[model samples]
Target: MEASGYLLSGVLTGLFLLGTVLVLARNRNWQHYSPAGDASGVGETVERLAGSPGTWIGGFVLLTLGLGLGTLVVVGGLPVPEGVQGAATVAMAVVVLAVLAGYVFLGVYHSVRYRGLYRSQAAAAGIWIVATLAVAGIAVMLLTAG
Candidate 1:
C-alpha cells in the first residue's frame, strides 16, 4: 500500500509538471497571437496583467517548491511531529485548493480574453483541474496514511 501511494504521488507529480508546461506554452501562444499593437479591450487588459514570461516562470518555481514539499510529505519522505503533521496536512490542502482556484480563474480569464479563440485555453484549464485534483487526493492519502 505504501508503495502504491508513492507510485500515485509520482504519477500526479508528472501530470502536474506536464500541465504547468502546457499552461506556459499557452500563455506564450496567447502573447504571440495578440501582440501589443493588435490587442484591444479584454485581450489588451489580460496581456498587461499577465506580465512577462518571467512572471510566469517565477510563479512556476514557487508552485514547484510547494508541490515538491507536499509530495515529499505524501511519500513519507518527510518527518513531522504528530501535532505538526496535521498542520502540514492543512497547509498542503490549502496549496492544492489555491492551485485549483487559480486554474479556474485562468479559465475564466481566457474565456473573456480570447473570446472566439478559447478552445485551447479551455483544454489547458481542464488539464490543470485534473492535475490539481490528483495533487489534492495525494495530499489526503498522505494525511490519513499514518
Candidate 2:
C-alpha cells in the first residue's frame, strides 16, 4: 500500500471499464450480422482497415516495438534503475518476447494466408490487440513514473 500506490489499480480499473464499454457497444451496435455470421459491415470495415497502410505500419510499431518495450518496462519494474532486475526479469523478458514474436508471426501469416489483398496487412488483429494493450500499459507506466 505504501510502496506502490493507487495509480496501478486505477489504471487497471479504468482499462477494465473501457473494455466493458467497448464490448457492450460492439454487441449493441454491430449486432446486424447476417445469417452466415460473416457477412456484415464489420467485415468490410475490418478488410478496409486491414488493407490500409497505417495498419501495417502501426501494427509493426505497436506489436513489435511497443509491446516489446512495454513488456520490458513491466517485467523490469515500473522504474527499473537499470536494464533488468535479475535473471528473473531477463527470463521473463525472453518469454514475453518469444510469445510476442510468435503471436506476430501467426497474425501475419493468418492475414496473408486468409485475408488476401493487394496491400500488406501484416498483423491486423494483432495490431488492434497491441494498440489497445499499449494504450493501457502506457497509461500505467506513465502513472508509475510520475
Pick the TM-score winner: 1
* Per-candidate count of clashing residue pairs (backbone under 3 Å): 0, 0
Off by over 4 Å in 2: 1-39, 71-146
Q: lDDT at 36 for candidate 1?
A: 50
Task: Give a tens-digit lDDT track for model 2, residues 99-121.
Answer: 77667667765776576632334
1-146: candidate 1 lDDT, tens digit per residue? 97788778778888898898878777753443553564457876777768878778988899899778876776677886665666667888888777777777667657655775566566666566666677678777976787
Q: Show the colliding residue pairs in model 1.
A: none
Each prediction's whole-model lDDT (CA): 0.73, 0.65
* Predicted structure with the largest lDDT when compared to the true one: 1
Per-residue lDDT, model 2, residue 110, is 73
Candidate 1: give its CA RMSD in angstroms.
13.1
TM-score of each: 0.41, 0.30
Q: What are the C-alpha RMSDs, in order, of all predicted structures?
A: 13.1, 13.0
